[model samples]
Target: MGFRFRDVLTSWAVPSLADLLLAALVVRPYLLPGGLDELLSDASVGMHIRTGDLIRSAGSLPHTDPFSFALPGKEWFAWEWLTELSLSLLHSWFGLAAIALAAVVLMTATSALVLRNSLRRGESAFLGLLLVMVGFQTSMNHALARPHLITWLFLALSVTIVERERRGPWRGFWLLIPLAALWANLHGGFAILPVYLAVVCTGLGLEAIWNRTSWRGVWRMVACGLAVGAATVVNPYGIGLHQHLIEFVSSPWAIQMIEEYHPPSPSLGEPFYWFAALGALAGLTAVSALRRRGVSDALVCLFFLISACKSARHIPLFVIAVTPIVAGELRWLWDVARRHGGRRSLVAIVHDMDLGLRPQFLRHSSWLPSLFLLALAFRGPLGLPSTFPEKSFPVEMVERNSATLQAGRVFSTDAWGDYLIYSGYPRQRVFIDGLQDYFGPALGNDYLEMLSGGPRTEELFRHWKFDTALVPVKQPLSRWLKARPEWRVVAETPLAVLLVKEH
Candidate 1:
């Protein structure tokens, strides 16, 4: 088929208001003075970047934990090796700005895919865009410079591809195998791919059996699921990857103590606000209008919703899974409105808006690529920031008291341990970091007990023989240390304090 003028215009044009909005949302994070640096909220990025650097330096992935003092040489699974390598390369080439920009690009692309998939599933343009925006907004809470962002992008692509295959032939279903392989190297979340395939396949099989239709697609889906599952073991750790991830996820301490693993709470702020509102709307629509949408959509939505309820970190996954269903439900409402004269105020407003009308000039603007190139070219080196945000971390205190910190064994908060590894790794190793698996339940519980100043806190500290401590100013350990004659205050910042054992 030759490319027609209309086809060219549709392909090259600015497209719709939704496209413009998505572009804006993607670039907005990079507009601040720090650009992508502003989004580096979590200290985990430091460890990830450092891991990537180490991998590049050694020319192979490490099989043991090297960043922590608590468990040096313990077997470690660098499941996010690919993402770490990519981040390190970006940081080396364009500085942290590039790494941050990469994150924004991944998130925006995921949102764009969701929007496209919803429209492809017969949703109206406006409704699709609205639903995608909600999903994007809900995910903003966890949208830091981490491997999870890459996982989100792959998850969206996997779902779109699988859904397409479910609706049609199995021509592109095999693509999931290579995707699974790549995903396995990028993040441990690759395990979700096989589960997603299984759920969809089972749902389709049940539907076919109930309606007495051909089971050809169900068999194909089963084949695809097995292929993807096999691909997941293609990483450096091979079968060990699955075993490590299973242990981590199944850990009671990780599930209960980790903030991200905790259930979504309205008390937490914006993440919950959008999640609660959209979740209620989606649930109601699913019950009333989405019955005919098929069992697969219902199963996927319910699975993600329950997962999100169990852990707030899964909210974005839930948002991505439910967006198309919500869009389809809204499309049904729009059709009903159209049948009833389409004169409803809300319907009239959406209809009158020229969201689909592409202007002639914008149809061939095509300057975005060149503009982005120019921006990156002119964008000079990003001078490393002297300190992290004091509100979120103890950057100032760490820098001011670097000598004192390196003088002895130091015990710090889990988040602070991540920052220390990024800033002071060779000179200093941490008691604990974001790597909950490396520490396991014993050390993790010990660290938590010290932080909470439990009865065994003194005993744990004595066993570790930590002479220097860096903790939040308001934490129980910090407060208790302040009153102890054996520990003397050495340095203090607005958000953090440092103490040293009396000589």
Candidate 2:
């Protein structure tokens, strides 16, 4: 063993850690602290909590609750009613910090689970780190306090369970059934669960057929999956739940209103995600060719690759679900170097070469070591920014307007919805929230019209009956409002504008 070989290993180790750490740190900037969507979700949570209070006053879930966006004459999910109620109660007890802490905790725990699942399949810790880095990068765009967080966690857990045994543990699958019930109540995206489970079952079915294995395993998986699907109906909605989902999707408003439903624009804002997807696809193809192809592996890769390419937000799901499959496919590549006749000689040389290097120089834990590597990479292939903020929000404005905000309804952009909700100001009701489905096509058209300098903007405003409009200074609404005598600027800053109706 020589010092040179040890030096070589240390050099290799250092860059890998740095690459991951830099990715982690860089992705952190995308997280939303005060984005409009967060503000909306938070405000919705607050209102739902207040509505629950009113329900306690009026008795039973009121047929129509004003504090909630789920009013009559409107198509609504009320999916997050429980989460809102819970968050509202938490806000009452622990305040905004606690609610925010809850969001962070959910995100961190889900991230760790995804990482754990990735590592369980023989992936290097680096792969988990990379996947998390990519997840944060994608999810950060809409990092508001919303039910998607719960869905993301559930998806990760369900996928992990499905991987080990497609039948999934009976008890665990039943537990997930209830979680699905909760998820149905929490968010409309619970549909992903059924779809994911279907995919898993199909994978298992294919595996059974291909290997000529026992139908017992396949049948058990199919049965559990059907049971889980049935449990989704346990909610108050009954069969209306499925009907509601169908109607929601069929509605022109649903497709027109939601950004997530919109297909990806390769020309803007998602180059990295697209790059990763393309690379993963190419990598998967190479891996598939190198080994015996499995139907499930091919299907999973195709499914996620298509999904991610179709929408930017779907990137996190692809990264979470597809990365493991990619890694598994590439497992053969990891073995390639060992196949050559000189492999043993190379291994001996490498081992002997590292003998003299200090153990301190050979560190390889995770992102912590990756930090130094990131700094160097930033100047090269990584090309990440040198300094990244831990938070991606205008906290000063939030603190400054907290009291005023507590006194009124806020009309905000999609980005700041959850932040306002989490702020827990009782007087606050948001004009909109992340429940983009609730708004339907009409409101979305109106919003687009408004943002695009629509002439009927004022009429649309009167229609929604908004109290106060909080917008980024750059919005066309700011300019439009400033010219209108009916609206007065209440607060103005370089970053944002708060406008209130003139008395």
Candidate 3:
């Protein structure tokens, strides 16, 4: 197993296109303008980190609304506490940059695993590279620094293991068992793992019935499925986590109110374009898979396609799970076209280009690992902001009005409410924040009514005793507050306005 000169030359001197792409994927996000800031733009990261700190100090996970005066002592599920703890540790040690780096690492790991799985499935590197961009696009769309980033990595890893098991022995498939446990602790998305394994097993059983797959494979899938399912319950909440996720995902109210729960629109551009394109290609692939009794793919594709169609958040799940299938389909289509069509056509050119890429395709080098390490070392020191961007959040405004924000019963946007918690948690509380599930429709609707300057605005404000209000300066809510004789604008930034009620 000693390395020859040729091996050394190829492995050390020249990296593959995949290797370089992996490097670019990791560094580009942090290097781009406001990229690190953009990752922290979501206020949920603040919730998770603060919750982590609370858990760490108290030596237990929180079960009540710890950051909100609106719903104090409500039965709250801090289901993602493991991820929160991790984020807390990173932020505690390295500031916000570490969380950004962690996110980049998660996204990069997902992408790298997808690429490896694609190449392993005999996908042509040229086409694989192009189609895998769909996964990258999905990552960029939801690139916020949160626990779900961990889910992205786990999803890609779990799917790849399942696919490999279908083709070969259940060698590394056992990893999913412990992975399920860990994923269960990290994010609510762990529910998807058991569902995915069940889908794959069902598909394998269908293939077995058609004699396209061995019964051994089907039984192995069943064993793996049961193992993973059993392992998932080995979390802090046990089966309760599953129950909570079921209720959350099934809640029609959540579907109507939460933006991510809504179906993706094509008009949103490239993210949806890739999703729509891959979805169409997946349909064709699934149909073709049926002839060979490879119903595993058909089921997998069909299930995820519907999931993607129903929720924009599930778009990444589809992209990670189905893009390889789409890449294989593209390859099959390319091969057919090249064989039957004119020699000088686009098909012939792509075929030739793919052939040219083959030698470098398999080459491995230190570039990707080296670049990732470098990115990690430089990330914090490199232009990472100490807090959420001022342009995005009312960072300076919060500092300037700290007295009013911390001491008074404050009302603000859900996002800014989250920031308020981050800034003055264990002391100050918000009228509401982005934890819409915790708040429920009753309170969320009331908050929305307040924002709308609706009939409930006065009654709710009086009931809640909200003496301090912070909102985006340009919103009608701000103007509405300013119009009230009992309220006066104390300060205003281009991004946010602070209003205090006249006593």
Indicate which candidate wins on lDDT.
3
lDDT per residue, candidate 2, 311-422, as tens digits?
Answer: 6557667666766666454445544643553646774444343333213222333444344434333433433221111143344666677876666656676545544654
lDDT, residue 262, model 2: 64
List candidate 1 segments past 4 Å from native.
1-18, 27-38, 288-290, 342-375, 378-387
Can you tell me which runs of candidate 2 are displaced by over 4 Å?
Answer: 1-62, 68-77, 123-139, 166-175, 265-271, 274-279, 282-291, 341-425, 428-433, 458-472, 485-490, 496-503
Error of 3 at 467 (Å): 1.2
For residues 169-192, write the lDDT of model 3, one tens digit per residue.
967888888998888889888888
Q: Estimate each model's TM-score.
A: 0.90, 0.71, 0.92
Instruction: Name the regions of candidate 3 deviating beyond 4 angstroms.
Output: 1-15, 25-33, 338-366
Residue-level lDDT of model 1, residues 1-503, one tens digit each, is 36697777666655455456777876665566655555777888888888898899999998877777777677776778988898788777876556665676678778877877777664466677677777777877788878898788998998789878877786887899999999999988888889888878877887787678888889999988998899888888889889888888988887776788898887668768889878886677657543674666667777778888899889988887778777777777777786676566677666555245323212323344444456566556434333345568877678788888876788998888888877775576778889876677888889989998989988988898889999998889999888889999988877888999987
The window of 10 residues in a row where model 3 has the poorest summed lDDT is 358-367
lDDT of each: 0.77, 0.59, 0.80
Clashes of 1: 0
